[model samples]
Target: MARRGKKKGRPISGWLVLDKPVGMGSTEAVSKIKWLFQAEKAGHAGTLDPLASGMLPIALGEATKTVPYVQDGAKVYRFTVAWGEERSTDDLEGPVTKSSDQRPAEADVLLLMPKYTGVIMQTPPQFSAIKIAGERAYDLARDGATVDIPAREVEIGRLDLIDHNADRTIFEVECGKGTYVRSLARDMGRDLGCFGHIAELRRIEVEPFTQEDFVTIAELETARFGGQGDERSDSADTVPVDFDAIDALLVDTSAALDCLPQIAISDDAATKIRLGNPVIIRGRDAPVEAEEACATARGKLVAIGAIEQGMFKPKRVFAG
Candidate 1:
């Protein structure tokens, strides 16, 4: 017999769309949520800089297993680029390294915006987490060592100039994973023949999750204690959380798997795949999705074989 008053065990799975406030690191937010829910497993998709704020999806329980799917999703951000100055950290947090006497008009920024769209080679800022020989580049830079990280290719699907004031310009960006908005601001300034840095940044969306689905830290804390009714706040600054909000943001791992061509299998084939075999993929399906499912199956996904003589012959198995 069970104890009458014993609390139920923690929920096995859920996704938290956090409207991260400024001044907290990504990991700190995850830790707080983990404590709040007492969840045994948790992880965030992409990391947001301490100076920035907005939608940060924290996966809990079995949802943590789907993080890679979310991580690979596209991101949208609204940021302010401050003209006439540049910073070491590429944001307001870093020391000013350069300043300009000239301020350009909105048209100048609009003209230069086109150059950033589409595929581009970008050199990440030195003050970044990118590793060089297993040592973080930022670590080396802070120690007064010179680190030259070669430029890599990244795609900027969309870059639009939203508004411009005398000293600051707001822009919206839709970019692939690994696209650094700080670096974009720095390079855009260079192209304009002026120095600049990101003054403010907020993620607007991360693929499936939008601004409408987010819940700020304050709201979350309030809800946890039942201080306020679970009604959605109407503040533009506040993202609402509801059933639809959760459903919209919660992307199943299989959706990512669907990106690849799927290979159907029999019970025997599934068992073989569970046993550990290299099943050759006939076409590109969601690699992360397949990998995730395989990991969930204790390292066995399914048996893959060629369809020959109107029959499926087991060729390779991805298994434990």
Candidate 2:
């Protein structure tokens, strides 16, 4: 077996997709994984609430440089919304401050689901990490200070009603990076003339990464000790885990380039772009017909350059 740090005492570099277990905060999980892998550097792409569990991309060493890329990817979640009651935290963990005398009918909820889909404005919960006046908003709220949080525009590509029970409504949501499903549920209750909060939340997917790709913490621990089974076994209980499993969960740092039309640069152009010089890009793939339109579109961390005259010059380079 090739020991991770056997060659030298230095840390190994790669990505790890942790099926973050419930209870541990995102920071805690990163710390444990870093120690287990003996990685010198590590960071998570996004924070998953301690109450929630699922895909968390842990970037190690050089991969940490790509964290920002994955942070912007679309996320999909499966959560349960409990009706007839609202809480300060907007989730089951919060204290209930209000309840309704009337129960919401299934039809009422189904009718209101469409309103949450697509682009919408959502005010984050007061008991959140969002900052206000240079301090965490939740910290202010906990100190008995009332703070008003402004609503921000977020895109919800899809919000589907998956199942419903008497008091719990199950939903699957696909939304942009910053969308808050808990706030969406709270607001949905408001729209329906009732109050509600999130009951159970589980992230089912993170754009390219899905539940199928996740590995439980127990499995990871076992893999670490070589006790649960072979570290590279092919059996269902001992399937080999590879660097790509972690890489697959990461939206390539250059994924934003996919949104734009690309031009295949000549070898000379590629070399000059790698060297860091700006060149006037023309021909197909250059910002030509839709220069303004392309500029307005969301940009990704990409390598851009072109060949002008006989010299290749580099243009803009995004974070990698």
Candidate 3:
């Protein structure tokens, strides 16, 4: 029999709310963090474009199982829309596609707010991550292919004007997952008789994470290598980092499951749940029915499952 190779990197697990900087894509950010921590596995809950900056929740090791919960949560963004010219990418990065001399009045912009609020249909930008027949929309656009992307429903919890000027307008929006801020800028521009594109954009909040929870890439680097920045390590393969300090920056894995119903179980029950077995939950106040629930033993998370007929059935178990 052949010997199996051992997995490399530490088995760290948790969520890291990264204050992602501009000019770095979400996948690149995750890869960098994974290298910084030397973790065996890592993934991001949602994608943030290179042009967008702010909260990007990263999951490492066992926490990756809880990604869907965080990804489905609401997002808050503060963006500035540049008026008079629309771009091919719906941002400053692309060539000008349309231009206008008219700028919308403050009253006119405010009047149109009601139309965008609540549930609305939105068409994603051509230069977006949306898949078109197994290919990215942006890929097709880059290949000079004209793809007719269909509009879809998205929820906007709140949309407010933060500041306005003759050439640009700043607005803060709280919207559901899959909502595109660039689309908002483009559509609003067309409606106002002015062409527009995203001049600047920053996401401040994602559900289950507060503004204060995010840590910058610089901060993570400093924590690992002691403020040396790029000169901290002589070699990328043999870089020494402060594991304790870097690990301290990670939030608990259960934090992402905050929205789900939580149930407490005994160690014995937890053992069974971890072994992929259902256990009967006791107590009169215990939940009898829940479509989605989290089970915790003592203080640590055990499994994500559902309660049916007073039994806790484990769907996904976490390693201790």
Clashes per prediction?
9, 2, 0
The residue-by-residue lDDT of candidate 2 on 196-243, one tens digit each, is: 899988887775566766766666656565455324333432323643
List candidate 3 stretches off by more than 4 Å: 1-7, 231-242
Report the lDDT tens digits of candidate 1 across residue range 1-320. Answer: 96688444255355778899989999999987765554567789999999999989888766665577678888999999999898988899878989898787999998899889999999998889999999998899899787898999999999988899888999999999899999999998888878899999999898767777787766665555445534434441233343242333333433323333355444644554455543433334424223222322323234334443333344443323
Model 1 error, position 176 (Å): 0.1
The Cα local distance difference test for each model comes to 0.72, 0.69, 0.92
Give the per-residue lDDT digits (tens) of candidate 3, residues 41-113.
Answer: 9999889989999999999999999999999999999999999999999998999999999998889899988
| Model 1 regions lying over 4 Å from their true place | 1-11, 228-320
Highest TM-score scorer: 3
**Model 3: which ten-residue window has the lowest total lDDT?**
230-239
What is the alpha-carbon lDDT of model 3 when measured against the actual structure? Answer: 0.92
User: Ten-residue segment with the worst summed lDDT in candidate 1?
Assistant: 291-300
Order the candidates by lDDT, highest first.
3, 1, 2
